[model samples]
Target: MGRNTRKRSTLANRAIVASAALILGGGGLVAVNFYASAGEGWSSGPRTQRAENAGQQVSTIDCPEVANELPREMPRQARGEVDRELAAIDSQITDAYKKFADQKEQIQRDPQLAENAILNPLKDKRQASIDRITNAIGRGGNKPQGMNNLAPCSLRDDGNDQGDGQNQGDNQDGNQDQGQDGGQDQGGNDQGQDNGGQDQGQDNGGQDGGQDNGGQAGNGPQDDDFVDIQSIEPNVDEPQEGNDASTGSFATDCGVNENGKFNPDNVIVAPGVANGAHHMHDYVGNQANDAFASDDDLANGDTTCQNQGDKSTYYWPVLRLQNGQNENDANADGGGNDQNVGEIQQPSEVTLNFVGNPVSKVTAMPRFLRIITGDAKAFTNGDANANASWSCTGFEDRQLKDKYPICPEGSQVVRSFKFQSCWDGQNIDSANHRTHVAFANEDGECGDGFQAIPQLVQRIVYDVPPGPGFAVDSFPEQLHKPITDHGDFINVFDDNVMDELVDCINNGQKCQ
Candidate 1:
């Protein structure tokens, strides 16, 4: 069965505040919950009507997120086996997606063909993998229940090429759709006054083969995935601060990936599994990093950070131009083989800024603290954890959540991330790869049990040909949607550096 059906680049979190809000709001939470109502059916109207349309097309696969179902305290001994099994499940889904994409037409014509040939077989494979995970986790006791629920995958009917594009009401859910369209869609492209940067895309010579998702490597991006940046309203709000705010800032000079460290491995989520992320990632800060790198390896690894004492690892999905081009990984596991196409673009600037909390003194992050600020599966999983934002240089006040910004000529595109700033004070990691760390509240205070730590406001700028012709790498299933863009960090700072950082923040001293 062919599995490659091009769906709408998910409607995604509407009009989320850009990273400028983090700085202006003094490290406020990105307010992800405001967009979490998707699963609650609030965003189901457009999809329901679309699904019932006789002409609707099943574009992508939708499966349960098994990781979110794991016990908070998984048996320590079962983690390895569980992680491997989970990775296997992901691979099973990817393969199924491939088959489905290949035969979408045949399956579309004969609905039963999908169930018998693809869905059923996939369920069986996933069930087996889940069973192994259950056995591993329950070897000495009771097994988790309802795991079968995670095995039933479904097909989504996107109905037309986005049914008027990605900014359609569904992507905005109920609240932001009207605001986004009213505020920007009509704002005119006057702000897109290109300053000769139009060649950023045409410079590729030609956009021949439609091998990319719009300008990507897979089944996404479509034309609706981009919007003119100048059209977006200035939405960043100044943050409120408390008298006890840490109030200091520090910058770590980690050069852009000039040394060319790249990989698709996610040690925190699928350790020991190569190409676990299914997309290319640009690495900076630490030289020793991969699916197999252990904490010890990271501790002793060389760093790109100017401060050698800070061996922290920082990485994120690489952005690519849709201008049909091939890179070294074109045929590799995380590249074309996984449907992530186009020529990879290097960042013109990468800034690692550690900002102080607005309500409390900051503490040292535990060594090896692993935190993920955005959801890599956001295209399918919803945007409860999506914290990244997009904008253009000079237009930083307006950030986009779901749509990629079409920068005017000479205006570079930007990706920004404000990493979670609260720690649980004990564990460095958690079962689901989150949960151990949390974002400060809108008021900049950590929760009852969480302590304030340095908030990493990461910003990456790309001088790509200005327009909507570029996309960040994403899982094949995710379709290169901007919402799927995410960042990863592993704090390998030695004790001395950590102490120094903590002191600088608490004492309101700006330290490099």
Candidate 2:
């Protein structure tokens, strides 16, 4: 009732009001923060998780189990699609070749500025074509229907019915073992689950004008779809003999090893069933995971889509195409390590060998060796002797001290490269995990086909020449027979190899 009493009461009431306002604002902020965090997690569940894992220094995901069996042939429709795509690709490539030939002819006639300039333009076009085709095929192409966008399967369907309705007889033993233990708790309809409900199983026929037409998704590569073989004129007459024999068909040439092994495990090649590299794409496939309304939908027919994840699975490492012309044994000079060899080349190699009793014609001989690496500098480097950061940030084994993750510091990961079209157990088997080879290139973009390549379906990893623990004599003899003595295969990791690879870059070389 007094002036003092009224003033004190007014002040106290204002303080209380301010306190309540503060609490409400604070609560609102907290609520919004919580919602934002949850929304982000939900929106980027697979992608963010992959990126985080990428930066992580440790690898918790178990190495993929190798599938010993060859992939069944592509379904007729899929094969047909590939055929069409490849045909178009071939047309483009052929045009490029024609242009290249014309340029070469011009060079033969003029032997001057025209040769230098004209060859470069054609070469760029060729390299672009090669890159486009290689990426398209290797990444399963961009055709909407036939193309699987590297998605994983939904509910981890155990039905081994690849796109075809028929069962492919329960995939691999490893997969079967996993299925038995619920390792792949593919929560969905079990085989022979009660089908008493609704007498009519719905038939959602194929979409009008679907690419499959009426073809069933068969088990493997189509009979008619031929993989392209691009290389110099291969010498069939001079067959590789003994362990020293090399078919000269390496898909990816990382480097040569001075003291490499013949074992397939030590060597790197294409995918095989046993070592788990074969089915890596199953999880990373365009059809990794997908949702279906009913079991009938799956039975009706649908290409499997891999589940959401880093879909960059099948991208062959960045390959550095080797120029067959330059063969300088970096180990030839004074028995010291030849730092000049393959220094500018990029992408470290992973091993995949498919040697099945009845190997897939697709696996006949590796046509394309996908070299993948994380070297940021491989493409940028000008010198051949400088160190190439052939380290994929996420994949490299960084625990080692020398920084080079694939091979040890002093010793290099030299793969004793060889190719055997023969179905011999002595060579790489799509079944045995041993046949896949792994090597390191100095650069990141090897698959472009613009660089100088060393050999064929085989890639040879090497140490700087004068390999690891070599005596003096090891250098010269190893130089003469790099592929034989398991010594560094002679190819300039120096200016010469780079110069040749650069020529490839500037002048697109067609597959012979």
Give the best candidate by lDDT: 1
Q: After superposition, how far is residue 51 of candidate 1 from its true place, in Å?
A: 13
Off by over 4 Å in 1: 1-54, 140-142, 159-218
What is the C-alpha lDDT profile of model 2 across 345-416, one tens digit per residue?
221333322111111111222222222221111111111111122222232221111111122234333221
TM-score against truth, every candidate: 0.81, 0.18
Candidate lDDT scores, in order, read: 0.68, 0.20
Residue 387 local lDDT, model 2 = 16
lDDT of candidate 1 at residue 147, scale 0 to 100: 82
